[model samples]
Target: MPSPADKLRALLAQDKLHVMPCCFDALSARLIEQAGFGLTFMSGFAASASRIGQPDLGLMSYGEVLDQTRNIADAVRIPLLADGDTGYGNAMNVRRTVAGFAKAGAAAVMIEDQVAPKRCGHTPGKAVVAREEAFDRIRAANDAKAAGADILILARTDARHEHGLGEAIGRAAKFSELGADILFVEAPRTVQEMETICRELPGPKMANIVEGGETPDLPHKELEDLGFAIAAYPLTLMASAMKAMVHTLERLKSGQDRTADLMDFGELRERIGFNDYYEVSSRYETSRRD
Candidate 1:
């Protein structure tokens, strides 16, 4: 069987845009796989919100994120790209972060240029580290990969928010040259800026499509035309799921019928694999009796 990294590499080799729906936990990851999506990213913002009911302002610790990654990755056969927020410290820490995520079964681990306590890409007050420090983080991550981490390095730049697009492109170019497997320039405000990023950078490029964020939410073909290999929907699943839950809760509170808003219990059990578990367990029961 192909490893997750191998699966991701094969996907990148294709000349088309892969739509990636980001997931927060194992169940969500499994849903993405069952829905026939080729890839999924473990969104840090969603994970922070789900795991601790907190914002994505670097509140979740490294150990917490790693445990989440392990569960999500193990729950799906599709490739999982994990968010390694600010690498949790310096360049050496970046190395450890990369290695840990790899050991946790991540196909790829993203290390970004944001300073410690990094905010969400679409949110305000986020600043990147100095150029050298940013470059060093990717360099250290690459070193870990070179030293047998068994994971791809996704080098991301948030400099576009503070510095100009030129600076962001420059940092991403340097990251690519430093052996990053994927390049992500976060929050390009316009389609032209998005085009410029894909034009300027090499290797497999990713476009982050946060709903109502700075980047234009172009259609998948349009993003592919702009030279992006992957189009990531960071909050679509989380946002949609939350909206449904909230609506159902309102109906329940008002003593209104929520049957239309809820999934059938039988289907839910199958989706959660209870049906499969019972079937497999029955085989063991009969054999033991004999």
Candidate 2:
């Protein structure tokens, strides 16, 4: 069987845009796979919210993030791209972070240029490291990949927040020069800026689409026309799930029927793998042997 990295590479090779629905947990990852999506990213913002009920202010520890990655990766056969925020430290830390995610069964790991204790890409108070430091992070991540981590390096830049789009593109170009497998330019405010990013960057590029966030939520076809390889919906599923849960809670509090707000129990069981588990375990039944 092909490795997860191999599968991701194959998808990137195709001359089309892939719609990636980001997942926060193993169940969400399984749902994405069952929905027939080709790829999914483990969004740090969503993961932090779901796991700890906190914001993505770089509060989640390295171990916590890696454990989440392992569980989500193991829960699905499709490739998982993990969020390795700031590499958790310096360039040396970048190496360990990259290798750790690979060992955790992630197909790719994203290393960003944000400073330690990074904020969400769409949020304010975001700052990129010095040009040299930013380059070092991608260099170290690429070095880890070269040393046989068997994973892809997703080089991300948040310079557009503090600096300008020019600076962001410059950093991403250097990352590509340093051998990043994918390039992500975060939060381009205008369609023109998005166009410039795709025109200037090389190799597979990912566009992050956060609902009610910095980047415009363009349709997949338009993003493909702009030369993007992947269009990532980082918060759509999480936001929709949250809305449904809150509505259900409100209905229950009002003494109203909540069945319409829920999934069927039988379908939920199958989605969670209970049906498959029983089928596979039947071969070991003691009664069958008798």
Candidate 3:
């Protein structure tokens, strides 16, 4: 069977856009795979929100995200594209970050151009590092991947807000030149801007569809027509899960039974491989007894 990285590369070679849904945990990764998605994305925003109960303001450490990546990768057969915000530090740190994620089994690792302790792309007052620093970060990531990491490098630029579209495009182009497997120009506000980004960017482009974000929420077909190789809905599952949990909790507090609204216990157990664990246990028990 092809490795997850190979699968992602194959998907990129196709004409259609590959839609990657974001997953914050192992369970969500499994759900994404069961729903027939070819690939899944690990959003820093979602991970921070779920794991630390905080915003994606760079509170989570490299080790924290790496641990989550290992769990998610273990739960699904599909390729996982993880967010490696600012490569967790400088050029040397970027090298270590790439190696860590690769060792943790990420198919691709996305490193953005924002400075350390970066905020979400949609958040106000965001800033990017100098061009030289950004280039060094991507170069470090590319170098690490080239040195047998076996993971694709996704180079993202948050310069559209602070540096204008031209600079953002230039940075993406440079990142591609430096051997990034994918290019992402974050938070393009309009369809025209998205078109320009897709048209001008050199290689496989990624479209980040954040719910209620600065970018326009164009359909997959439109994104495909605009030359995007991948379209990532980074916040859909997280937002839905949050709302559903809140509603269920409120219902329970109001003396209502919301169990009917959830998956039955048996089905939930099956989905989580309880029967498989029991089968393994039975085999071990018989062997040990003999």
Candidate 4:
């Protein structure tokens, strides 16, 4: 069977924009595959918010994120692209992070140019590292990937806000030259900037579309027309799930039963593969009896 990385590379070779939905947990990952998505992204913002009940201020540790990545990857066959925030340290740390995520079954790992304990791209008060240091991190990731990680390196620059679009484009070009398989210029505020990034970036380009983010929420067709290879909606499902859960709880407190509005009990069980476990149990029982 082809590996997830191989599958993703095949998809990228086709002449269409790949849409990767952000998955926060194993259940969400499974649902994404079931819904016929070819790829999925594991967002640090969504992971921190869902797992630790905290903002995407880089509070989650490397181990926490890796474990989550493993679970999500195992839960689905589709390729998973994971966020490796500042690689949890310097260049050496980036190497280790690349190896770890690859071992955890990630098809692609994204390392950004933020300082340690990086903030979300959509959040204010963000700061990036020096150019040399950022370049070193991407180089390290590239080296790690080359050393049999079998994973793609997504080099991201959060410099559009702190430095400028010119600086971000420059950094992206440098990263692509350094062997990054994909380039992500995070938080471009306008469609024109998006077009410029896609046009100038050397390799396959990624466009991040967070709800209420700095970037314009252009449609997927428009993004493809701009030459973007990947359109990542990292916070769409997370935000929607939060709102639905909050509304459900509020209705519950008001003495209203919304069970009928949700998935039926047996169908939910089947969705999670309860019948598979029953089949295994039946086989074991038959073997014992024989």
Candidate 2 CA-lDDT value = 0.94
Pairing residues by index, what is the TM-score of model 1? 0.98
Lowest summed-lDDT stretch of 10 residues in model 1?
281-290
**C-alpha lDDT of all candidate models, in order:** 0.94, 0.94, 0.91, 0.91
lDDT of 1 at 119: 96
What's each prediction's TM-score? Answer: 0.98, 0.98, 0.96, 0.96
RMSD, every candidate, angstroms: 1.6, 1.5, 1.7, 1.7
Q: Write the per-residue lDDT of candidate 3 for residues 174-273, one digit (tens) a residue.
A: 9999999999999999999999998888889999998888899998899999999999998999999999999999998999989777988998898888
Which candidate would rank higher by TM-score, 1 or 4? 1
Q: Please write out the lDDT profile of model 2 over residues 168-264, one tens digit for every residue.
A: 9999999999989999999999899999999999999999999888788888899999999999998899999999999999999999999987899
What clash pairs does model 3 have?
none
* Candidate 3 deviant stretches above 4 angstroms: 286-290
Q: Which residue pairs in candidate 1 collide?
A: none
Model 4: residues >4 Å from true position, as ranges?
286-290
Off by over 4 Å in 2: 286-290
Clashing pairs in 2: none
- Tens digit of per-residue lDDT, candidate 4, span 1-290: 98878888898888889888999999988888889999999989899998999999989999999999999999999999999989998799999999999999999999999987799999888988999999999999999988888899999999999899999999999999899998999999999999899888776899999878889999889999999999999988998888989888888999898886678899889879887778777768675564
Model 4 accuracy (lDDT, Cα) = 0.91
